[model samples]
Target: MKLHISFKISAVVLVLFAITVGMLVDVPRLDILNESIRNLFYHVTSWFAMVFLFIASFVYSIRYLNSGNEQHDLLAKIFVQVGMVFGAAGLVTGMLWAKYTWGAYWVPDPKLNGAAIALLAYLAYMILRNSLTDSLTRAKISAVYNIFAFVMMVIFVFILPRMTDSLHPGNGGNPAFSGYDLDNTMRFVFYPATIGWILLGLWISELRFRVDSLSQKMNDDLDIKSDRLDSIPRLDEE
Candidate 1:
């Protein structure tokens, strides 16, 4: 009945429909990439979702630091968790694609290394949040750490990869893709995949935030009700 729940269900249905249609329709691929580039739907979509959430986390962290709001910190933390899930999914899909195309499961490629480091940095953020006992302390410390981690994510995921050689496309000396990797037909499917998955990620993260916020509110309300009942005076019978 809740809007968040309804949105979640809608997201699932939309994703399924998109996947079905994407598979059914034929997209013209470039000569070099061939059909192997079809994996872009999943790989690029997941990374786009991850980056969007990570940017959200970074903004919220700055907001929390400027305004001293715990909700911002909590929201940022939740978004980071969601981002990590998306990043992991991207990594797995990338590995699978690489296995088929590059004939290797793992490579010390700059982009891959950077992506792994970025994921670990965010994972460390989660661990750091859980380590503190006091809520305020946890929030303050985590906010600082998140700010640093976000900076590192930008550096590792973008800058470092550009400076070094990578097996992955869109990097230096790699025979991967240039601006021509994604043709017009693939762009049609790819754009929707990106937007749909990012929207789906937000839908899930928003539901998670609502569940947590509602649960906390419910607990606080119950506590207040219990205290009020305890404070009530009873009249003695004559």
Candidate 2:
């Protein structure tokens, strides 16, 4: 499917707005997380986008399993690939935020550990895909793995964080995004930033899908041409 121009436009607009407002808006001067709190707009938004992309991939994997269509499989793979990019960005930003706030880049926080494990799990999925030689088998197995990994990722990133103690906000005794942490001013930028990053991820996945589709088509055409050439009977026997 062709990507709509409006989607691209909206992503650009929202991202610009996020950067502008995130920098311009005056946040309350907290003890350690004074200016660094602005990372919330970029860091949190990237993870939100990653989650959105993974959800899209998970749905496409289900469709692939039901219909056995390679297109759906391709869509699922591309979505995960894009999701990983955003996931990596989120990790980097989170590390930076952690360094400033927690006095260390790598902490024993459950949420942080969960995020790392989730990313590693997805990376393992990619490795599994590459290890397979048969296209159909690869698609089927990877689809199943994708669903399983996604569920585990959700449990790791969302469930485990809340269940255990963590220095990150919105967990343990820390103040959540609501109330004072994310006041009226920050909300304006945060929501749009999330939507914008998700849209951008979708745009990237679409582009990758198109390229993969074209390559598949070209390979199929070559195979058909080779078969046709092989079918022509030689006159040597007659």
> How well does each candidate superpose onto the true structure, as a TM-score?
0.84, 0.91
Candidate 2 residue-wise lDDT, 116-228, digit = tens: 99989989999999999899999999999999999999898898899878888888778866546545777877899999989889889988988888778766766778767
Model 2, runs deviating above 4 Å:
226-238
Candidate 1 structure, TM-score to reference: 0.84
Given candidate 1, what's the lDDT at residue 41? 78
Give the Cα lDDT of each candidate: 0.79, 0.88
Superposed Cα RMSD, model 1: 6.1
| Number of colliding residue pairs in each model | 0, 0
Screening candidate 1 with a backbone cut-off below 3 angstroms (N, C-alpha, C), the clashing residue pairs are none
lDDT of 2: 0.88
Best by TM-score: 2
Indicate which candidate wins on lDDT. 2
